[model samples]
Structure formats: C-alpha cells, structure tokens
Target: MASQPIKSDGGSSSYYLIPNGARDLLDLIEHKRMEFGIGNIFKACYRLGEKDGTSKRYDLNKIIFFAQRELARLPKDA
Candidate 1:
C-alpha cells in the first residue's frame, strides 16, 4: 500500500496503514527474522517500519500482538 502524508503537531509525515494489520505485521516479523537474524525482533520490526515510513500507521494492538508472537518463536539460544 502507498503511504499517506499526514499533518500533525504542525509537522508532516508519511505512513502506510496495513489493510490487514495482524497478518502484515506477522509477515514482516518473519521476513525480518530471516533477513536479519534473531537479535532484536521487536526493535527490528520497529526500525523496519520506520525505515519504510510506515510505523506511525501500524496498528498499536497488532504491533503488540505480533511482537509477543515473534518473541515466543525465537530460539532460546538466539
């Protein structure tokens, strides 16, 4: 999805709102794990969204949900 530019606090920013937030966040988590390894999934996910300019639009509930789900999937030794 294309990001929308929004104005807030007298500033402008762009963000993409996931059509299916839960599924998109889960897919993003898995993709990051594969590409970046399991160092810090939550932070990685946040950073990825920031880099992609989509973090602001990601649903807070879905973020928490996928973060916990991804953390549980991490290897104990990782």
Candidate 2:
C-alpha cells in the first residue's frame, strides 16, 4: 500500500506532497543521518489509534517498518 501524506487527516494532500510546500516534512524525510527514519516513525506513531479500520493497521505496520529500519541503522552493543 502507498504511504499517505502527514496531512492526510484534513488539509489538501497536494500541499504536503509538494516539496516546497511542506518543507519541514520533506527535510525530515530527506535527512541522511542516523535518525533518517525518525520522521516516518513518529508520523506513524502519531497516527496509531487516531484512525479507524485499515488506516489504523496501516499506521501500525508503518511504525514497525520504520522502527526496524531505525534499529538496523543504529549501532548495536556486543
């Protein structure tokens, strides 16, 4: 399934999808550090329980995927 924009709850989807429109969001997504997945992870977490039916499940799954990516990107202790 395709990922929904952060503003999917209300405002026009176009606003968020536009690179120059939602600058902060795009910046977070484009960040290339150890915390690259932070934006998506937090967005997914915020969506949890906020929506009904499939949307809720989608958010949960999204969180899991981002979390895994985050964990893999982090250094593990021996």
Candidate 3:
C-alpha cells in the first residue's frame, strides 16, 4: 500500500501508514529487526476497516529506520 511519509519535529524520526494488505510486510521487517533491539520503536500496525478513514499507523522512529534499512540494502546495480 502506498502511503504519505511524515517526519518528526526533532528531525530524528519519521512515520507512514500502510494499508491492510501491507501489514505482512511490516511484520516481516519487524521480525528481521527484532534481534537488533529495533522493534521497540514500532508502536503497532492497525487496520480500522473499510468504513474507517484510515487503515494503517506506524511510529516515527520505527518506520524511519526501516526505510533507511531498505535504502541501504538496495542493490548497487539497481
């Protein structure tokens, strides 16, 4: 799910809300980061249903870190 990324006022964090189908991606990333003590930053990922205005939520620090990790792992050739 595509989402609008948000940043922190302190300039040290960020956040994004992905749709329900994307929850698995969040879970997978969280699992990978757990051993490194990085999961603490994630508050939770929730879907309020189609009737609700929004369907996803992410903590600033967690999402920001995840995004950085993804960027770092991108193939140099790509």
Whose TM-score is greatest here? Answer: 2
What is each predicted model's overall lDDT from 0 to 1?
0.50, 0.62, 0.46
TM-score of each: 0.28, 0.46, 0.27
Q: Flag clash pairs in model 3.
A: 14-60
What root-mean-square deviation over C-alphas does model 2 reach?
11.2
TM-score of candidate 3 versus the correct structure, residues matched by position: 0.27
Residues 1-78, candidate 2: write the lDDT tens digits: 134435466756654343454455446455422254677776567567676564777888888898888778768971
RMSD of each: 13.9, 11.2, 12.8
Prediction 1 global C-alpha lDDT: 0.50
Runs in model 1 lying further than 4 Å from the true structure:
1-58
Model 3, poorest ten-residue lDDT window? 42-51
| Angstrom error at residue 20, model 1 | 26
Q: Is candidate 1 or candidate 3 better by lDDT?
A: 1
For candidate 3, lDDT tens digit of each residue in 31-73?
Answer: 4444332343333332222224433343444556765775677
Task: Show how many residue pairs clash in every candidate, following the order shown.
Answer: 0, 0, 1
Which residues of candidate 2, in runs, are more than 4 Å off? 1-34, 49-54
